[model samples]
Target: MILGTVLGLIIFGGIGEFSKSQKANSLGQVKYLIGVSYPNLNGPWQLQMNKEIKNEIARHDDTRVIFTDAAQNDEQQVQDIHSLMSYGIDLLIVSVDNASTLTPVISEVYKKIPVIVLGRGVKGYDYTLYIGSDNQLNGNMAAKEAIRLLGNKRGQIIEVEGNKESLQAEERSKGFRETIQRESKHSIIETINGNWLKDRAEDELKNLLKSGVKPDLIYAHNDAMALGAYQALKQLKIEGIKIIGTDGLNEESGGLRLVKQGIIDATYITPTGGTSAVQYAIDILHKVPGLPKKIILRNHEVTKSNVDSYLTEGDNSSIPFIKKKERKIKLGFAQVGSESEWRLANTDSIISAAKEAGVELILKNADYSQKKQMDIIRDFIKQKVDVIAFSPKTEDGWEEVLMEAKNAGIPIILSDREINVEDQTMWTSFIGSDFVEEGRRAGKWLVSDSKLTTTPLHIIEIEGTANSAPAVDRKQGFNEIIQQNSKFQLLQSYSGDFTLDQGKKWMKQALKTYGTEIDVVYAHNDDMALGAIKAIEDYGLKPGVDIKIISIDATIKAFNSLKLGKMNFTVECNPLLGPQLMKAVKDLENGIEIPQKIITAEETFDQKQSKKEFSRRAY
Candidate 1:
């Protein structure tokens, strides 16, 4: 198949050659080659996406897209990506085939160039950006539609699934099953594998019906499969079964048209994000600042009654517009606490940025109390603030409060820290540094320094606040890198609560217990590392010389300590998120879709580099 595709490319005068000729036609002009990988082009849904992408790119003379169809083969998709790379494509856009298998390959590609993942997301934060729909919500919508179709009657459901390994398939199945179990008097009696193809869905459903089992309702993961299931019912002379599907494409054979023709009852319009993906790809290639990590397009339900309105395409005549009220946008912000220099700098940046943006700011210091932060958020909701932003002290226990905020129609932006919540839609967006990457940088520095000697180095760790996002993610990231080398021994770890006192106390206890066995000390923040330095001095040992110190948060004090030969290395967790946060607040007020996760730019510093970069330290 690969050879055939290559030969076909040659027969068609080769897109790469065409691009080169185009580039040559205009001297000194820059042209970007974008590679688009699709799982298959067998269905209207995928074809529509390809058409939309091509149309959007046609508007840009400087960009050319080379598309590849994997024909629903996972290995073929990986090979196609390599082939595209061999052609020297500038960027890649992939609609993942199998997330489990494709994540590693995509991540490897991301190491070299920008990759835009569409439709389905892979395992990790390796890609440049993800543009896709909320498949789980589509599943929820499908379940609700199924319930409405039953309308006070209990029914058995037959679910026609797509590729099992696909993230979209898994999430859709999970959302549908969980919702049915929780809210409706319906049970999914049997699940048939469709593999996201019409013929396979028909064959599978026919086999299931041949086994003398029947269902009152059919829910397919996509429209093609839904249509196949409907055909199976027609062939088997089965009637009165309500059919629901996803991907409400408006093509002649799409879900919208199918619903209009009474072939399927309802469908959730899962936007392909093709046009948006192209736009974002251009922006990314241009190095646009403040772009979102993930753009989640909205999905709406389409049925026979509303299918005509959707078929009209771009008609906003029936939609009502509300006039905006001119007033200062009220922003309620809650700071975790001033436990360290970094925390103080972070708080000051937000406060100052809010003021500069002409936003009415109601700022509160949680003082390391999650309860206090929740109280402040509740108060913000009560005051009917336009926007609420807070840095969570810990990763859990914000679900109830956030749900309340969501119920009150208030948009929440998470600042600096993240939370562990099931309903992610409770928060609009998260703007913070990548904590895991910071930990990985610290671990990487330690690994690189360890090359100087072969002896096993025993390390002591002073962690930040227990169960906090930074502490947990940093530990995980550090461990991920250190596990690669067996010579690094982690002696012990202690929580510092991001406080200098706790850091000093923990370091003193570790020194007293382990004495000189500790070869290196890894602190989660600059304050803790400073405290560890004090404890090392009290222990009558050199800090940078005897026990090399590694920490996060490159405060001026840490830089000074590095200059004074007290701290060895400090990974920077940039705290200046003021501009980004204020911009997000204003954007949210203007009803813009914010990216799911916005990562702040950061870097690392060592003892020598610290002297040169010290003057540039803002936090």
Candidate 2:
């Protein structure tokens, strides 16, 4: 079977030269060489496979795992396979870049050494084994739920699909449309291409809405699209429309969390099966009987009712593990100075997490100096630490120094503030609160209550440090939300340098400029809000009553203010990221894959909830 009709790579040339130069081991052997080619190492799903496969390889004494990334290039994958075979790899596990273009290599490689195709299937390839979930079956399962949502009544389903070129998109779409047509009266009114991106899905769904279709229910091929579709309809004043999604990843930013938070109605679990794939490979190596040619791991729907089983916070035992090492992990953390209570909390969170995980953390405060931060990072490199993490002072001027660290073989993690490096591979992972979403939550809370929406509410935004990611993105998100309603007006917005003193001075100026006209004080953090509260009191006005105070970073101080009726509302920006960072570092040490961007889950709080949450608040 020739799955690839377009490829023209010559595999025989390399095989002959390599065989002449080196001795190929016989079939029965004590040692084995396992080669795996991942699609790319950036995504959460891809990282899971990398983790599981590497873990499986680590469990064996005589096995050596050789890894190469196709980096989403089909041609490069062909070259990578030939390179692996040149080293006489005993077995090969490949998540092909493109099933069609890379099928020729799969056909050639399986004949020499056993090959296990990772995720997708080629059209006409007979591989040694196939271990992955069937997207078409996942789509059919989604349709089954859609039928139940309709309950034998007629309704419309708007599907936000992945890219049209993708096989997963085609299969999921075909299965869904066929099932809907055959089993139920529900019709797919519109199917738009999202390119498998959240922003694209939002824009496409908005364009679909412009054509005047308020769907009865929506089924997105992925969770990001479903979330985007939800956001689009929400902005258009549509509510209560059920949405279903795929790839129920178990992370803070993934579909399982979305289901837990009620952001999306449902999502299907898509397994990485890296461990299972490697296990089957080991099984075949030992000639275990009754092994199937194809293995489809089961996937199920995750919704609000059964989401706790998939929740990370509720269970500490589920934290991903690596093999125990003799040396305690040595980590260097560069903080952006103690500018506010939030910074203090974030620093404490990192330290506490390090302490709990038994990691020896070397701490340094850059005092908001980009040069000083770079120097501190270089000092870590000099110490030859196991890993380095930092909250960058600014976005720019990081590419060169980061490249140096990467060259030195130190994995870097960005904590809170992001860097604008040219090459993204310079850093390992970014684990922090999404500042834009934090701002959106604040603005959404401000406008949610009907009583506050009655009149034109003039808002004074006390921003964070100038040009910092949190400051810039928080302003952007807040402005985007408040601009939706004409009743909300931004009277004045200025950066307070994310300091309490600056916040007080800025508040005084804003009050002087607009006397008795301020209806809301929207500070980017709790420290600034506390400063504004002091200014309000000094000016002979009661805080929270005269001016409805809304802020971000629900720290203990902010919660205390809320308890005292000094602060009305605050959105949470959790800074406790030690555990998450430790997990990534451990995985990196063991040659596992980690996501490019890891976001933390947060919540919005009113004065009433503050009373109950103040005691247990860690940040």
Model number with the top TM-score:
1
The residue-by-residue lDDT of candidate 2 on 1-619, one tens digit each, is 0111011112111212322223222322236667777655655667778888867766765555667766555677788788777767789888854667778888988888888887666644357777777688788878888888778668988989875655678888888888899999889998898866778899999988988997889999888788889899988988878899888888866889888888888888787779878888998787874344555554667778778977753331212223346888888998879887788877887888788878889999999888898999999989988888999887778888788788877788888778776355587767777688788888888878534457798999999887788988899888888898889989988788878888889998888899689989999988889999999888888899998899998889999999999999998887777777776687766766555456565777899999999898765
| Model 2 pairs in collision | none
Tell me how candidate 1 scores on lDDT: 0.85
lDDT of 1 by residue, 1-619 (tens): 4653464355323535455335422333337878888888888888888888978987776776778888888999999999888878899999985999899999999999999999887976788888787787779878878988987878999999999989999999988998898998888999999998989999999999999987999999999999999999999999998999999888877898899999999988787888889998998899996566666666768887788888986322222111244989888998888788998898888888888999889999998888999999999989988888999999988889988888877778888898888566688778887788889889989998888888899999899989999999999999998989899999999999888888899999999899999999999999999998999999999999999999999999999999999999998887888888888777766655555666775667898899899887776
Which stretch of 10 consecutive residues in model 2 shows the poorest summed lDDT? 1-10
The lDDT leader among the candidates is 1
lDDT for 597 (candidate 2): 57
